[model samples]
Target: MRLPCIGILTISDRASQGHYEDKGGPAVETSLRAILAMPFEALRRCVPDERPVIEAALSSLCDNDGCCLVVTTGGTGPAPRDVTPEATEAVCDRMLPGFGELMRMESLKQVPTAILSRQTAGLRGRSLIVNLPGKPSAIDLCLKAVFPAIPYCLDLIGAARLETDPAICPAFRPGK
Candidate 1:
């Protein structure tokens, strides 16, 4: 089987500048590695919380790098620097609002501050981009909530086919 190409982007001014360690990006990588049973490769990037930079990175990953799925961490809060969602919307061909809604809804069960999160997901060409919060625990929570449909979404977008371990993350697809 061909390996799936995935992009992992971390949007944080401090982490990008090397002022702080990036916990969220690694969390995403670990989660994907643990759950995805298919052959896959990840292209990782760390950038500051700037809309233009994020937009450029997203475009390059989806268009140039040929990443079927681009998962971004950080810049989903109410802060002015939090423009990951805006950048994602700008580059994507369509918005998948259900992802953000479901993430927030699931996270609300954990923390009341989930209302402040603006996590979102979208599609650019054949690539699916998901904006996630910076916190590592929040990453785990959000991924668990929405990842069941991600593989199928990528399949529908003509990007790649992703198979998951049923015991770890049983993906929900019709006629499974």
Candidate 2:
């Protein structure tokens, strides 16, 4: 069977320009590796915090590359350049607001500034696009907080089936 294709997108001005090493992309891969029980291919990309660039990358991943899920890190902040959410919203046909809401609610337990996060998730074609904060720690936290619903969401969207390790993050699926 062909492995499910998943995209790891890192949006950062410095990382995309090679000025700073990209930790968020790898961080997302690592976290997913630990949480996912099924085999999959992780396609990684780094782009500057430009809306057009981010949107194009997202389109390529979902429309061209056929990524079942695209999880992005960075550009979800209050900064003017933080446009991941906007780009995702533009590319996605339907927006899933509960993801950002749950992530923020969970993150608020750790830091008061969690309210500043603008993380979100949406669906583009059959692919699920999720936006996450830039910090590696926050990436892990937000992913864990929201990933429980990811598999079922994929099932609903007709993407590739994704299962999670019960020891890491047990996925929720009704009557499964």
Candidate 3:
């Protein structure tokens, strides 16, 4: 049995240039550690806020690296350079808007700025790509909001099997 591979891509111009620390990527890794019940490897990448770079990274992670899931941090806000969602939509076969809806809805409870978040998720071949907010804390909140359905989404897309710790996040796979 192969252990699952999760892609953690951080999109930030300053972070990519070493001008700022990449806290969002580490935050995702921490959440994965707490939520995942089984062993898995995280394939990490950091790139500037460029759509082409983001697109290429997504393709490489899903098609070449054999990653079943790719979670991107940053470039989901209303800023001029925020284009992660667009890059994601371009490469994905189908868009799952509910993930964004749930994330924004959950985030709204914590801050009014959640409405400004344009986070989204989509299916790229067998891989599931999720766009998360740049803020480290928001990443945790958004993941908590949508992660329960992630395993089942992966199942539906024929990706790798991912089991979550019941105490941390009880994944719902319907009738399981």
Candidate 4:
């Protein structure tokens, strides 16, 4: 069987231009590896903070690459360049705010500034796109907080089945 594809998109000007190393993309991949037991390919991309570029990348990942899940890092802040959420919303058919709400609620326990985070998740075609903060530490924290529901969400969206390690992320499915 072919391995399922998961999109790992890092949105940053410096990272895309090679001025700075891209840590967010790798951080998301590591977190996903820890949680997912099933084999999959990480279809990674690094784009600048431009909204149109971000939207094109997201659209390509879902509509062309057949990625079941697209997880974006960075550009979800209050800054003017933080347009990841806007790009995500534009490409998504349905928005899932609960993911962001839960992530923020959990992140708030670790840091008082969690309220500043604008993380969110949505569906584009059959792919589920989740926006996360730029910080590496925050990426794992947010993923851990929201990953349990990911597999079930994928199932609902008709994406590739994602099995998780019970110790790492015990995915919740009805009647399991």
Candidate 5:
């Protein structure tokens, strides 16, 4: 089987400038390592919360790097610098709002402030791009909620095939 390519992007001004360490990107990588049993490679990047930069990074990952799935952390809040969703939309051909909605709903069960999260997912070519919260805890919660559908979505987009260990995180497919 071919190994899938996953892109991890951290959008934080402080983290990008080396003023602080990036916990979100590592959190995402850890989560994927725990759940994804299929062979995969990660392409990681850290950039400031700039729309153009985010868009360019996403474009490069999808168009040039040939990543099947790109998960971005940070810049999904209501803050002024939060432009990850906008950049995702600008690069994607279609938007998958249910992923964000489910993430927010799941997060709301843990914290009421989840309503303020603007997390979203979109499709750029064959790649499925998802915007996640910066906080490591929130990232864990959000990823657990939406990840079940990610492999199937990637399959539908002709990206790559992924199989999960049912004992760990069973992926749901209609006929399975």
Candidate 6:
């Protein structure tokens, strides 16, 4: 059987330029390590906040690399350059707004500025793409809030089956 594969794309001009570290990507990786019960690989990419570039990377990860899931960090704010969600929407076949709703709702508990976040999730073919906040702390919180449903979402979309560590995050599979 093939091990499940996912992509982690970090969107940040400074990080892409090497002026800053890509903590958000690693934070996602760490959460995956803690939450997943099976083996998987995370293909990482760092790029500036360019819509075309983000779309291309997301496409390449899902279509070319055959990644069943792609999680993006950053570029979800209201700034003019924050376009990850738009890029995601453009490339996805269907949009799942509940992911963003739950993320913002969970994030709002930590900081009021979570309202400014526009992170969203969508399905591109068989791959699932999710936009997340850039902050490392917020990434963990958002993942915790939304990941319980990811495996089932993947199942519904015909993506790879991802089992979660019940001790860390028990995936909800109805009638399982």
**Which model scores highest in lDDT?**
2
Clashes of 2: 0
Expressed as tens digits, the lDDT of each residue in 15-74 for candidate 4 is 999999999999999999999997899999999999999999999999999999999999
Which pairs of residues have clashing backbones in candidate 4?
none
In candidate 6, the residue pairs with backbone N, CA or C atoms under 3 Å apart (3 or more residues apart, or in different chains) clash, namely none
Q: lDDT tens digits, residues 12-126, model 2?
A: 9999999999999999999999999988999999999999999999999999999999999999989999999999999999999999999999899999999999998999999
Please write out the lDDT profile of model 1 over residues 19-124, one tens digit for every residue.
9999989999998988898779899999999999999999999999999999999999999989999999999989999999999999999999999999999999
Say what the RMSD of model 3 is. Answer: 0.7
lDDT of each residue in 43-149, candidate 5, tens digit only: 99999999999999999999999999999999999999899999999999999999999999999999999999999999999999999999999998888888889
Error of 5 at 9 (Å): 0.4
**Total backbone collisions for each predicted model:** 0, 0, 0, 0, 0, 0
CA displacement after TM-score superposition, residue 153 of candidate 3 (Å): 0.8
TM-score of each: 0.98, 0.98, 0.98, 0.99, 0.97, 0.98
Candidate 2 Cα lDDT to native: 0.96
lDDT of 5: 0.92
Q: On a 0 to 1 TM-score scale, where does candidate 6 land against the true structure? A: 0.98
TM-score of 5: 0.97
lDDT of 3: 0.95
Pairs that collide in candidate 5 are: none
- RMSD of model 6, in Å? 0.6
Instruction: Give the runs in model 5 whose Cα sits over 4 Å from its true position.
Output: none
lDDT of 6: 0.95
RMSD to truth, every model: 0.9, 0.6, 0.7, 0.6, 1.0, 0.6
Among all windows of 10 consecutive residues in model 2, the one with the lowest summed lDDT is 132-141
Give each model's whole-structure lDDT.
0.93, 0.96, 0.95, 0.95, 0.92, 0.95
